[model samples]
Target: MSSDASSPLAEPAPAAGGGGRLVLGCTPIGNPGDASPRLLAALAGADVVAAEDTRRLHRLCAALGVTPAGRVTSYHEHNEDTRTADLVAAVQAGHTVLLVTDAGMPSVSDPGYRLVRACGEAGLAVTALPGPSAVLTALALSGLPSDRFAFEGFAPRKPGERARAFAGLADERRTLVFFESPHRTAATLQAMAEGFGAERPAAVCRELTKTYEEVVRAPLGELAAWAAEREVRGEVCLVVAGAPAATGGDADPAALVREVLLRVEDGERLKDAAAAVAQRSGVAKRELYDLAVRRRAE
Candidate 1:
């Protein structure tokens, strides 16, 4: 493939009467080979290329053997607010504006949402060139339930916020996915163990698609210990098994009472804890609340 800016893959100019459109290009998370052909064409042909990092965009282009013919500008968190209007204006002027982030799709825990929303509100056409995603990759590699899951993005950085977030999801039945910095992986895993339960099955996926890609599968407690024992490196994704299905009327009353007490010990109000546990176990919330109160007294 020619690295020339005028490569044949570049699309021809839009028709005279056609209004311009906003194209979201999904970049490779790790390996450059993951770049889609559509992404390459968009980079070469778009009139304005808005990138999270122009240098990284050039690096990707270099690796893909292509040169962007368009004008490239930085469009990241810091500049997103200021740049949205200009980018939208470019599109309105009948110029194709391509948005690319450092990795993965733009607007996913990255810059681009504001621009997209602005464009949408202006009645401009918006489209995406979907490609690599760490969320799907990690979930598939997790060997856990993929049929249904929730993407929690990144866990809260503050200790109290993180605890409350995890506690709120304790009874979530769908599998959960999370992203965390390499430095905080151990600490986050420890918190997950504390909030989700020590024996909850989970996977720690890091450096996905790169040379050192590693996915550690084990109980949350074990993963926490593993992270603590070594220096974790690279971007990390966490996939955790959700709460087990409620056993309905067959559930052990004693076990349910114990579960309620655990939540109370974690600082949840007795009534709130009982209601949450009751909903998960298919028990009457009022009965569960009374039983928990009596158990506390005992």
Candidate 2:
């Protein structure tokens, strides 16, 4: 669930056309018991199955006692674009095209995005069989503030880009959830510790809902060191705590106000300048920005 005001991806126009043939079925993120009747029905009735991993699809169907009568086509990140048209066409022609990802919802961080976008654009009926999602699951287990959070699917592979990415999110007051590969988990955790601070509390959830699952709760620095020393296998979810609360009572409000105003005089946006002062002085943005303006006038 992206909170972007104009989320082009989250919502779909399911009534446009296509004779209600295109189906987006969500498999369980973890527990097989999470599987829904809709998912089983879709598996049994689809005319064509576009799966991120065909083998996993086979196993999933086997677990649910569903023998798919549809042609299973590979529709993963590597081949989603090329195959979207064919899948959509089949649905538009009144064939039930079921889209399943390796796990979880299709479009959040998977191959179903292209096909869904294509269906939305084509005025085709794009219904969903919602079941489970790792993003919401981890957020629930994190025990962090969940009123607002952002899901950054995966961080950049390169270090510099990753640094800038974390810097941009430094002032975010809401909890942040992200997925990372086990192979690069150490690198990612190290960078997070560096960018978000080694002391920030975080939870490393691994192989969520699967057997042999592990959840490590600790400060970012400890986790970073722990991650580097060993091999981490399975899906990884990093739930990092939000920025620390302000320590406004320890500082001279008047003096801090003067300095913040000077920086705003240098042409920074009010919101951004306010955020900067908040991070540096541990002052509330609302109070600092208001004082900055008052000091500027006086």
Candidate 3:
């Protein structure tokens, strides 16, 4: 907080306007104790609450000892697109609409993005009540490099496609974070191991900031096996180490050339097959393609 004489914090509060406002409130990602006092006041004072799930919002409000002063309209995945104009209209009409989601900040892999964008387009003041974020939480706990990181959301759902996607990131030097579903986590880890190699260190953070939260640090292969038999629950975020720079002593280039030729032999298209081989072997596609042509000609 700046100590200037005319600082905004020191300015007298303005009266609630008749035809303007929206509050993009941030709720606790997990623990109720994580809720900031500003969030509590926002919920209690807003004229309308547009939440991802009204029941969940109610539960949160109950835990915080806040009985909302106005109605809560559902603003979620199924209806956010259609509901944006109406919600924006309410704000234009002077209703202070409060937005929240199941976890973390809404609009981040959540539904409030559209509404927030709409409000911005319509010249309404937009601000956040910043609070807990799982992405930051998981990264801090993962024991991976955090000075620079990439959030890729989630991996592709298909098995082979997912592997190819991971393979593309095999050269990324920055730590990578991702969101994963409970059911698909095992397959995700397996694909990651295949891409980054089973030896790459990674962490699986589950139910972050909650009572049952867990963080497992191990090689991707070990995590994959650990996930196979368990009924993993809650939201999961994974932190994966970026690919290590190659030294002089990796697998022989002749063996890699042989592998590329084999994929082509198995009815994979020259173009598609070349990409997959390039991903797996960390060899440039052009180099592999030249070797591929030479092998085929012979």
Candidate 4:
């Protein structure tokens, strides 16, 4: 059951003694204007403000022009494990503990999961003031299918591991999103090209909502080539179209392979041509791609 959108927000019945609860607030991903009014109230009212970076929390407060009337403390990955118990105890002791990350919601590829779990297990009251998110922001901006999507946070750093990971998702039918750094963006894109097929449609979103925001939509191979040519910078959100649905039709394998090869000869990359034909003819993409490449070499 969900609340009606038109209904006024109802305040939850406070834990015994009128307080002792955990509040997870989302900071702005990039822009300060996205901060919600409830978030502003939480920032100024919570008894204890636990931030991924206390300095950044201060910066955000400065930008929002609201000073927190609480004890500011650090709660990041390195200290989350050690500090979880204390934060939980604070909530139990009638303290309003607000957990915030540097940007976006905590525990989504960030800290706060352990504390949230601990608080939940202790049967303490916990809530969130939702705001901005990079995953949804990038997905909406990518112009890709949004109904179904998967967020693969930060592609594996190692080459072999990353390749295997991408290979595992090669046949996925839902759109895929990944977080990547500027320096590794080119290499990661190239690897995705090889694993998911060269022509798979994708978009590289950079510095979302920031002053120099940029989004480049193209095939995986072309994006890879573009990244390789220059130094890609800023935060990167890579969104790739999923593999086409398998039709399970009785399309002749030989005929499909020939069709793929014809497109290849018509100047399309072999993988791209194979994927396009596979989607339409219900042929196995990798099989058709392999056959086309082999025939082309011959």
Candidate 5:
């Protein structure tokens, strides 16, 4: 037997033992079954529930048999700037504000960053209820290296910009993850192939955790061709393997230092440039940074 909307689950109570805290609740990406008991409780008892989409929140509540005993308001990109102040005010008034998005955690390619930042600046407590994340889910399902991965929320829509973005990360050693629209998946994959090379290993995870979920893993060129041949639908995540490790010789500190310098000249910070080049080139970050600094001193 499955629990329904009218089941005898205990009514959830408001968060206790905290003062003026903002609770960032992560919602299910697809399956309602992924909703946590604590999430249901938070929904039922928060003083103010700020959701990216109120209709979706209601649907989730109906599925979970939860009746939010709180004021529900819209908090999306359009109104995030104006609403951040109001939501922060509610927290300042000692109310538990539950922030949720249509899917996944707030502020991951979604709204809620402003409100969270406001709360932090106001010295109000802010915490999260971790839950399903499409990034991690797709990465895990991608069969790509999860040990070191980067979640770049969404790719740029334009062809030129998107290609440039991929070019920037072309040397990134850590596996790269990105979100894309269903309609643009094929085009994006094609652009990726152009930037990252046609033979690079990649995966396209579609409709994750939902019916008709699909994971297509292959070289960038093959994935691009596959996507073009079909009408790809549903939420999409792309995971691309990192650049292959350097072979045939020992790691070159000088080359690594020069790579870091080149990245820095391209507007990246020295530390960030060094870290990124080190990862892709298999050079120690500390050693690379020291060499770059010494070169700068020369």
Candidate 6:
């Protein structure tokens, strides 16, 4: 079968219609070769193809040499709210609707969640054709432990919001994964170094499966410095090592006090800082605060 999207090719016979189904098709993240045969078949046979970016979807179809027979429609963040109902309606009319994003699986930091929810609430049959995924790929490539991990889609754009976001995950014991733009990668790493500890190990995976792919593994502090010195580009994935296992014994009161003071210097209220450090370190806030006061006197 010639896989040229523009080339004329015989279409497969449509499946016997009972009721319409919603199919979530995963696309290649970088390399087109990662696209699966099942994905191609689904794309070619769907009654309506809803894509995050119609242009990118066309490019993918051209690259794969398989043109979709269904009407292609835009279904992105800007119009997802309105387009979702129409897509669901198509499925309700006994037409197979395929949902795809520019890359990876739909609804993974991508559009399609609303439509998926609608399909489920309507009791429509939904299925998926899985393929390339940047999250799993980066986690596997990252030297960090991946036995257990969490994916935080993107850090907040503003510095304070981003810092607070990191602060909430400061004590996450399992490995952490995040998607960051090239421009914000450095700043995010810096915030992470402060919130999670400067010496916390992390890996920055860039342009996975592409020609210029790079995976840099280092402590959060070092990565922050490296990012500061150069222009980092491409799709970036950050895999950070989790917090160190807490000792059963109480944390040193002096160390906890110093941490609280540092947070205070960073503009956090002293009491709130003490509470935060106490909760994270398993030390009593009142004891730590009294120790800090006495130390200040000396």
Q: Is candidate 1 or candidate 6 better by lDDT?
A: 1
| Candidate 1: segments with Cα more than 4 A from true spot | 1-18, 248-298
Cα lDDT of candidate 5 equals: 0.84
- Number of backbone-clashing residue pairs for each candidate, in the order shown: 0, 0, 0, 0, 0, 2
Candidate 3 per-residue lDDT, tens place, 168-278, comes to 676688899999999999989988876777889999999998889999999999998889878878999999987676532474455556555555655678877778767
Q: Pick the winner on TM-score between candidates 2 and 6.
A: 6
The parts of candidate 6 lying over 4 Å away from their true place are: 1-15, 248-280, 288-298
* Top candidate by lDDT: 1
Per-residue lDDT for 119-226 in model 4, tens only? 999999999999899999999999999999999999999987787677567768899999999999999999998877888899999998899999999999999999
Candidate 4, position 219, lDDT: 97
Candidate 5 differs from the real structure by a C-alpha RMSD in angstroms, to one decimal, of 8.6
Colliding residue pairs in candidate 4:
none
Q: Write the per-residue lDDT of candidate 1 for residues 148-170, one digit (tens) a residue.
A: 99999999998877877787787
- Candidate 6 local distance difference test against the native: 0.83
Q: What lDDT does the true structure give each of the candidates?
A: 0.86, 0.77, 0.79, 0.83, 0.84, 0.83
lDDT of 5 by residue, 134-222 (tens): 99999999999989999898999988678667767876889999999999999999999877779989999999999889999999999
Q: What does candidate 3 score in Cα RMSD to the true structure? A: 8.4
Query: lDDT by residue for model 6 over 38-99, one digit each (tens)?
Result: 99998888877788887888899989999887777778898877777777777777778888
User: What is the TM-score of candidate 6?
Assistant: 0.86
Output the TM-score of candidate 2: 0.76
